[model samples]
Target: MKIRPAVRRRSIRDRRDPLLTALTGLMLLYTLLPLAWLVINASKTQEGLMDSFGLWFAGDFALFENIATTFTYDGGVFTRWLLNTLLYVVLGAGGATLLAALGGYGLAKFDFPGKKAVFAIVIGAVAVPGTALAVPTFLMFSQLGLTNTPLAIIIPSLVSPFGLYLMWTFAADAVPREVLESARVDGAREFQTFFRIALPLLAPGTVTVLLFNVVATWNNYFLPLIMLKDPAWYPLTLGLDAWNKQAGTAGGEAVFHLVITGSLLTIVPLIAAFLLLQRYWQSGLTAGSVKE
Candidate 1:
């Protein structure tokens, strides 16, 4: 009799809650609808885009034509912007992740003076918005003759307060102190112990931070807009915005079709990245749930 009641409760707990399921379905639809619209509209030519329903395909499929034009148009400047974006992602996000990992590991493991002050500063930085710092950064960079150069964007992106805090918290629990003491007793130097032992254990958190920084760097616009004057240096976001604005100019070529097509192209890498790295992200989020 007791077992039957317990089994009934288990089944009840396993059953899906209708309200939660409905909300989840709605959220999924909300997320997918915009992407579907983008894909559908990308297939339309300029004429079709203005005439056809946005949610459905046009009578003529022009996706391939649009893509070819986007690549070959304006001396193939879009390709340059794509390369610039990649450079920012690789150097900026990669540097940020490395620094965050080293700093976070040190903060977690080693005892030092002013550690609490550093923690407070990190927390304060994470609370502050990037936009708030943009103007001051630009002014400082201008005085240093770094403005209108790639360094302006790259240097600022190398510091990620949130990434540092995340790694700090993760390193605190994910790496056990006993393991470090053992490594020390085994004659392992601090750097070797970190590189060989702690690094492998930090994979999930590292990947999570990398993805966050990657997305931020890839989508960055305002910073690049203020930093870069040369069109040759513009990232995809700024370049696309420039193309978008060109459509509104008097006697400018209407490249709205190209703009739409370019937008679709820009998000493909991000989607692929998230899909590829989601396992690590999920694992990172679920860390420290159960006690050993």
Candidate 2:
């Protein structure tokens, strides 16, 4: 028999259109430009910050000095703010992720009355902006005598509609019905089945939701602004804003260099978290994209 003609496989370069590559390059530059500027300016002294261009490093690489001062200045209030931010992230975002996973698994796997109504409510809540509910949340907390407390921030954060929805969608596809049936047949308890089997399978989704909630809680300012009158309870975002405001006031001590460094410091953890968990997030996104 005659050999079949060789199939022409598409090379990587042939598949990548010049227009799409250019557009992607432009998007990458747009996203990274501000971060580059921030990094450059964080290395500058106060005089350099004032005298040199923002996008380039100036006299003296004062990044390390600025960092040390950021931690030690004002009796180490920056350290306190960092700790508060971590506390809020752990309690609020962590709780939200746990709840979302449980609720999402239940919604996906169980048959219950009022389920349709619950779905409708979750979808509606996701569409509602947190800012719109800020006033109402503040009033509710005020009436309960919980204002100016960490609970004020943690409570609202525990109810993440988007995270719940994300987990719900992910769990539906990620966990097969047959696996649950097999686990039940093996006489495994419901909670045991979830904790042992479903939870491991839901890792990617959980990490994704956790990251979203962490970012949201870490950068929270509006809710804290309304709820807390105590500087001791302030998270990094709120504390940083206070510092920036002080710099702007007449006769106020200008620690603009410290502010720049603090801004850079604030994002370092987020960047680390993203870098570490990026694989999980990517897997979650691409899980069902291809047929096995």
Candidate 3:
């Protein structure tokens, strides 16, 4: 037999994409620059914050002292804000994810009347900026006596158009038609099929939606600013803003270091959540990419 001509495989360098590499580098710089500043300034004293370079340290290290002040100031209000933020994240994101999952799965798997209308409404709602709805939401809740309460935040957050859309696409792509039919043939109830069969395959998309909702609720300021009047109901975003404002008034109680440190502290949990859940996200993204 005649020998086949040698096939030349592209080397890694030959496969490299210049545009993607440049975009990745730009994104890295954009995301990390502020974080680098936060880390540097958070370790400095107030004087250092005022006098030193933003990306470098000054004369003294005050990280521990600043952390201590951050948690202990005003009877440990920062701790309270942290706890409040956690509560909001758990309830709001959890509810949003649950609702999105159920609604998305139903839309994808079931036949129902008004389905097209529902889809149209959801898409339209997505186009409407949430900030634009803040006034209407505040009014509606005010009439219902839900303003100034955690429910005010949770209720609004539970309705996420983007999350619904994401889960709908994911559910359609991830849960195969035959698997769902097999579940029905096995006499599994609808809810049982969803919770047992579809939910597992939906994990990556669920995590993505959960992460986004968590970040949104965690960083929420405008809604809470308008809805909540009580300090006890204030999330970290509001608490931090209040602190920053107080720091600026004449003869104001300024703890710039504490502010910097607290802001840094605010981000750690979200970062941890992303790191822990990244594998699931990657797996989910590739799960439907190929047909086996």
Cα error of candidate 1 at position 220, Å: 0.8
lDDT of 3 by residue, 214-247 (tens): 9899899999999999998899999998888888
Taking all chains together, each candidate's TM-score versus the true structure is 0.93, 0.92, 0.90
- Ordered from best to worst lDDT, the candidate numbers read 1, 2, 3
Please provide, for model 2 over 15-96, each residue's C-alpha lDDT reduced to its tens digit, 9 standing for 90 to 100.
6678688999999999999899989999988888888999998979999989999999999999999999999999999999
TM-score, candidate 1, is 0.93
Q: Order the candidates by TM-score, highest first — what do you get? A: 1, 2, 3
What are the RMSD figures for all models against the true structure?
2.5, 3.6, 3.8
Model 2 alpha-carbon drift over 4 Å, by segment: 1-16, 289-292
Q: List the residue pairs that clash in candidate 1.
A: none
- Per-residue lDDT of candidate 1, residues 42-93 (tens digit): 9998889888899999999999999999998999999999999999999999
Of the two candidates 1 and 2, the one with more favorable TM-score, higher being better, is 1
Window of ten residues with lowest summed lDDT in model 1: 247-256
Which parts of model 1 are misplaced by more than 4 Å?
1-16, 290-292
**Per-prediction count of colliding residue pairs?**
0, 0, 0
lDDT of each: 0.94, 0.92, 0.88
Tell me how candidate 3 scores on lDDT: 0.88
Candidate of highest TM-score: 1
